[model samples]
Target: MTASTDLLATFVARYPAQPATAFWRGIEIEQLARAFASDGVGLDLGCGDGILTDILFKRIGVTPRLIGVDIDPLETEAAAAYSFYDRIHTIPAQAIPEPDASIDYVISNSVLEHIPDLEGVIAEVGRLLKPGGRFYFTVPAPGFHRNLRGSILPGVSRERYLADLDKRLAHFHYLSAADWRAMSARHGLALDSATGYLDGKETRRWEHLSRMTGGLLHSLSFGKSRPIEIQRALRIRDLQNRMALPAPVASGIAKMIACPDAPDSDDIQSCLLVTGHRPRD
Candidate 1:
């Protein structure tokens, strides 16, 4: 099999049934890593569970001095088993434990959407990165919430249920590419590139199934096994075999599957990959 096919096979083996949207998100990050990865120190911001990072770098065939940080100790503990990160920190993204201007590269995978104080996090990213360092991330676009199940109700105003939905989904902001560029610019970072990912058809399916699955899990667990249901939905199938797989010999998994637009597509989906570089003094 080609390298991309091999990567997909490994992904399928690792996460046999991950949610369509999330699985694709990981794949997209793998693609971004091809350009954004550096051999110097790397930090994974909001690195919940660290599963994606573990698989991502392996697929890309490089391992820097990656540190994983998040606010959840439970998830961090789970992440510890993988050995993908040299160290891990449990702290708020805005209060990263790393020294100022020390990290060489920083990456966040599908993490920015959940942070409410987005500016604080952006500022912190700037503080942690060395001059000319880059921060690469993926987040829901402005259109994410539009087709979301909670954002549209037949009779009730979306405002009525939006808060509740955001809480359940851990979604705080779905920003535009322009918004990301502006936010990063304020933090002494320049927009490297920004582009949308995932097409509308897939996005609608993803959102619909996300709510549908969550509703089912709540019902099936007698509303008590919510945690397990969440994990299952996110496709954390194995607990013990956290060993890294050697990267496959081929690539292009992300471009072929997740990236719906190179630069010219007009259909609105839900997510965008944003890269910001810290300007050299």
Candidate 2:
């Protein structure tokens, strides 16, 4: 199997109950793995449960000096199981415990959009990074809402549906690449690259799968901060964790979820992979 296929298979096997998340994350992890530095003192911003980071490190086949941080203690408690991170801190993004210029890189995967205090977090990123330190993150584009299949559903108002969808996802920002560049510039992080990924069709498929895979129900019952809490309350994640599919069945399902779009596609993109760096001087 190709590397991309292998990644998808891994996620599918691990997250049999969250196939939509696994599918989307498989694509995302492949992109991150390709660019992530194998050596350095790195921080994983908003690293949830450390599952994705664990998978990423396994794929990269390295044990770098990495730290995981998140606001959710439950998630961090779960994250503590991963040996990949040197330390795990449960803290708000704006007040990371590390000293200034202490980190060689920071990665926040699909995380920044949910932060209302984005400027504060970016400012924190600027303060923590060493000279020439890199920052990598991914987020949905502004066009993501416009591309959703539900936006075009008969009898539904596109604006209302899109608005409700954003609220459901707890997304606060859908900035364009230019917007990211401008924001990074203000924070002293030079925009090295902003590449598009996950085209419109793939995005629509993702939306459909999310709803079909109980994501919509989770969204309805719990807000962004409540996912881990609710899951723990009901022990739903525990049950899901035990319900693994056979390898062949999981592979087939993963293939069905995988999109044909290259990790960085030029088509009307639904998401972005942005990279920037602090100036050496």
lDDT of 1 by residue, 12-80 (tens): 445433444444555465557666656688888988776677767876777657888898787788788
Candidate 2: pairs in clash: none
Off by over 4 Å in 2: 1-3, 151-154, 215-230, 239-246, 260-266
CA error at residue 273 for candidate 2, angstroms: 0.7
Task: Report how far off residue 275 is in candidate 2 (Å).
Answer: 0.5
- Estimate the lDDT of model 2: 0.79
Q: Write the per-residue lDDT of candidate 2 for residues 209-265, one digit (tens) a residue.
A: 877655556666754543435556767666544455677988898888877554434
Candidate with maximal TM-score: 2
Query: What is the Å distance of residue 202 in model 2 from its true position?
Result: 0.6
Per-candidate TM vs. native?
A: 0.77, 0.89
Best by lDDT: 2
